[model samples]
Target: MTSHHPAPRPARPVADLFSADGRLKAIPRKPARREALLAHLAATLFEDGRDYREPEVNEALLAVHEDFPALRRYLVIGGFLGRTKDGSTYRRQQQPGSPGGAIFAVA
Candidate 1:
């Protein structure tokens, strides 16, 4: 009698991605993959020369953004917005006190 066993299936490579720090890239918002993240953040957080608090900002971006300290730090270092000492608000650069800053708004 012939055997009834079936052939084994071929293995597929894992599409798993990772960051430089070896963190999982399953979040789907890597800088290399998504450069517009900060632009979106800037638009959502800034209003009338005012910035947003971490909680508020996180609420806005957390749902759609990946947790990247580099990106967050970039935003601050670039002077797109200034973080408050209390960590509760943001001040739009290039606003009233800013000599040369552009306004960001969601449209």
Candidate 2:
């Protein structure tokens, strides 16, 4: 018997998650969808090889949501963002070009 996995489709645009003025309507409730949304934020907001101070991180995140701390925590827990043990600096994690050229389906 053979087990076959379906090919991964491209990630959908998460624009709907945000309002016209570009603030999030709400953080997504489901984990997978949330991660995808965070990935979009991580990619767009942070630059590579640059470290952001906590204030800078907060300011950027606040532009997206008033609950910046929760968004920060979620981004860290989801591996979309990283920080030092002292929590003084934050940076976006480098994501690989879709491993196996696919994202595993999550429900």
Candidate 3:
């Protein structure tokens, strides 16, 4: 006799985490999922070489979610975005093994 097992479900796309209006429904509690969300936000919201002021960053983040402050903090902490020593400017950090190399060290 052979034992039967159910097939595994495919992983859901990150885009599904957002609402129909493009706002994030909720922040993921899982570290891996959260990192993926942060990476997507960094890639889409901020430019690689451009520097953004705090207000500008907030504006962009606010477009996707009401909790802009938490998203901003997560982006910085995840090394997906970098801020100047004075915290006046913010820019997207390069991914590891990218052409120019990563600007900020990822923990």
Measured by TM-score, the strongest candidate is 2
Clash pairs, candidate 2, are none
What shift in Å separates residue 101 of candidate 3 from its native position after superposition?
A: 12
Q: Write the per-residue lDDT of candidate 1 for residues 1-107, one digit (tens) a residue.
A: 33563433232222234445544355334332222334444555566465566766555444444664544555565455688887677665542224433233213
Off by over 4 Å in 2: 1-11, 96-107
lDDT-better candidate, 1 vs 3: 3
* Greater-TM-score candidate between 2 and 3: 2
Better of 1 and 2 by lDDT: 2
* lDDT, model 1: 0.48
| Residue range with the least summed lDDT across 10 consecutive positions in model 1 | 7-16
Clashes of each: 1, 0, 0
Scored by lDDT, the top model is 3
